[model samples]
Target: MPIDDFDLAIAPLKDLGGQRVWSLMISLFGDLARQEGQIIGGPVLSAIMSAMDVRPEAARVALHRLRKDKWIASEKHGRISHHSLTPEGRAQSQAASGRIYATPDDLPEHWLMVVTDDAETGPLEKAGFTTLMPRLYVGDASLPVPKDAATLPGQAVPDWMKRQLEPASLAESYAQLSDALHHVARDLAGADTLTPLQIATLRCLIVHNWRRLALKHPALPRPLIRDDWAGLVAHQRVAALLAAYPRPDLPEIATA
Candidate 1:
């Protein structure tokens, strides 16, 4: 009955690739094992995954894929397997961490804009600059400018730029995730205590989904965003739920 209710509460998450075992595992490492030489045992990984209804075989396959892709590396010590992020993997995870963990308060009010020649737009876009106009891009104040461009402080944002901030699909996706979190929080209230494994599973689901949506949208101020932006609501809800269900200790989850 508990699992059923849990499943229903988080049903909306499934549509957002919540069951992607490999991706979820990558997210798990990014959240808990990105530190230098941090390794998670195979059993510990399985224990937490079981909470999310992932099968052992699926986890193994995902690990295999991750290793093949250089996202993770594993060593077997006397039949006990330990896994850690590869250097490349850690780099990717660290790059994403800032966006994933940033609170609304972390965003700066002012931004930096770079206007470059049309031929140079490729490099700017690849470097995470959001397109504001042809050959015009905007990013956080700290964004570095290439030698050819002149950096200017962000001033008034035109309506056209605001409309371009978030595409319809991305806005809708964040709204759906926000709404799902709301449902889960309300449903789980006063429920029986969840095992450590169960809590870890739910936490992973919440973080993985939230991170994708949060990271996709650039960190910009409220005035730069549409008034009806769902990202703001999503971030608030995610923070609240994470506070309510804190991360369990690695040992507790692994043993459970």
Candidate 2:
């Protein structure tokens, strides 16, 4: 994986408590390397607490957890215990760095959309619509009419449809629509029957507007779309949909 891709993976970890510990560990290691080439336990803990603005007790707990997890090792030199990243810790950190720095191809499809969404300048601008534009299909006339006449049959509209109805206050609607698209994309990406093409499209949508999705749905984690891997199964669902609704023109052309 490219460095960029690894960064994307680590992006989610930053929100977890483990991230604080990881940061402190890295910082202490770097400082020790620059100064004495190694850090003893007491100084390591103090530096970590001071740099992280964490309580000494909290820093101690984090250090204990890291040691327990085997991310670091300690050896006694006379009276002081010197600490450093273990071989295992070094390997894990390198692996994490690769994940954080991985190339785009190593990244899932939805990540493309996320990149797009991050570039827009407006309060309600959604990203990657060019790749995964929603298609609105009206139900047949036999379907019950909506109580709101504005939503009558033959008037199917894209997620941006609300913009036409309420132009002046469309920002709120844009936020809602962007969020709904992210939800739909996540659902489709995780489904068992979506095709590769569909998954690709969904991934594009999610990557572009994940923040909007989180903003509109505060209950969702910011990295839900980025970290989830269930999207691989959604290809099966797309295949099923394609099988159920094969292109009609192909049959007619073959017959002709």
When summed lDDT is taken over every stretch of 10 residues in candidate 2, the lowest stretch is 217-226
lDDT tens string, model 1, 1-256? 2777777766666556545889899888987788778888888887777766788899889999999999999999998999999999999999898877776667667788888876556677667677777888888777778897878888888877887776566877887888888888887886788777677677778889987767654576655776556877788777887778877776776676
**Model 1 alpha-carbon drift over 4 Å, by segment:** 1-4, 156-160
What local distance difference test score does each model get?
Answer: 0.78, 0.36
Top candidate (TM-score): 1
**Model 1 deviation from the true structure expressed as Cα RMSD, one decimal place:** 2.7
Residues 27-122, candidate 2, lDDT per residue (tens digit)? 334323222233445544453244334577776677688788886676778876667776766665553443222332333222112122232323
Over 4 Å off, model 2? 1-19, 26-41, 99-256
